[model samples]
Target: MPLSEYEQRVLEQMERQLSSDDPRLANTLKHRGRRSVGRYVAAGLGAVVGLLMLVFGTAESMPVLGVIGFVVMFAAVAFAFANPHSHEGPQGVVEEDGTVRPAGPGASAKGARAPRSGKQPKAHKPGFMDRLEERWDHRREDGR
Candidate 1:
């Protein structure tokens, strides 16, 4: 069912909070709205335009122009298919009990990774962020 205006506003508020708190997590969980009838209309119109171009260009022996028009029409259909509505809910949240819960509409356990209990292992390899931070830290220490 379509959401009521009040419900939509509540959702928007919650989303704004999450996005502000952790942009990376919010991006991972982002949901664009569903493709509507308007998109179908646009696809139909694009097909009609492509058909006209093919008919006219073929008559003038302009095969390349006709191909270009057909490509545009295909792109329009591809766009419609790509814009699916997200049934996905929020991302996982850390609970007060020191457990992680998946961010469904209602809270649910999605299991957690076992906490590491042994002595810290040496780094196998440093990642790009690690290298960058290391470089900056070194530069600061050198008063550069």
Candidate 2:
């Protein structure tokens, strides 16, 4: 169920309070939603280059080059995956009882946003599956 306007305001206020109280904790709570495609592409290319280098080195009887290629590939893959901004969710944010809540609505989950313009972005309409789920939930709530 969607939050009422008052509930949403309260949540926003709490978030703001949390941020003010512990900026570090608030920053840590924020999720980095997704990574760019370029990172994956570079990693793939690096792997392919490494494989080609390994094959060529073997054919030409060069062990040193093969080792270098392997190192390069490993470094590239590590660099791509080790980015701090790639993390998601609320794994570190702990409650008073040592429980973590999944980042919910209004939670600071930063990712790519559409460029701002004079016009507001169109709201997404619920799909057939979503409507069906809503109906099912309503029925369950009514003790059907």
Candidate 3:
């Protein structure tokens, strides 16, 4: 379910408090919002160059050049896949420095807590029935 107005306000307040408390963390969070297009362009160029190298190497009968081209192609693909903005899925926990850490108990390496905001956000655990209901609701919405 969506957060109520009060919950939204509380979350915003918490975010502001966190940003003020740790500027570095805030900077990292801000950086995650968008990615530069130049990186994608460079990756594309790398792939094209690698393809050309592969074709030319094959035509020239140069086995070493063909291997190098394969390596280049692999590296380009790896680089593209490694781009942070390319990730599209459920996110994990936000670490102290705003980097994403895997979700689990005590997954935080720095053991950082939220800055003092005079109020701790209550953690809500959804019951099994509630979770089932939510899934059912989602399925209905999706016309499943």
Report lDDT per candidate: 0.67, 0.70, 0.69
By TM-score, the better pick of 2 and 3 is 3
* Best-matching candidate per lDDT: 2
Worst 10 residues of 3 by lDDT: 81-90
In model 1, the runs with Cα more than 4 Å from the true position are: 1-34, 84-144
Candidate 1 lDDT by residue in tens digits, 106-130:
4334343434568585455654457
Q: Please, what is the TM-score per model? A: 0.35, 0.40, 0.42
lDDT by residue (16-93, candidate 3, tens digit) is 876766657776687663555766787788888888889899999998888888888888878765735322125665
Return whichever of 1 and 2 wins on lDDT: 2
Best by TM-score: 3
Candidate 1, clashing residue pairs?
A: none
Backbone collisions counted per model: 0, 0, 0
Candidate 2 colliding pairs? none
Q: Which structure is stronger by lDDT: 1 or 3? A: 3
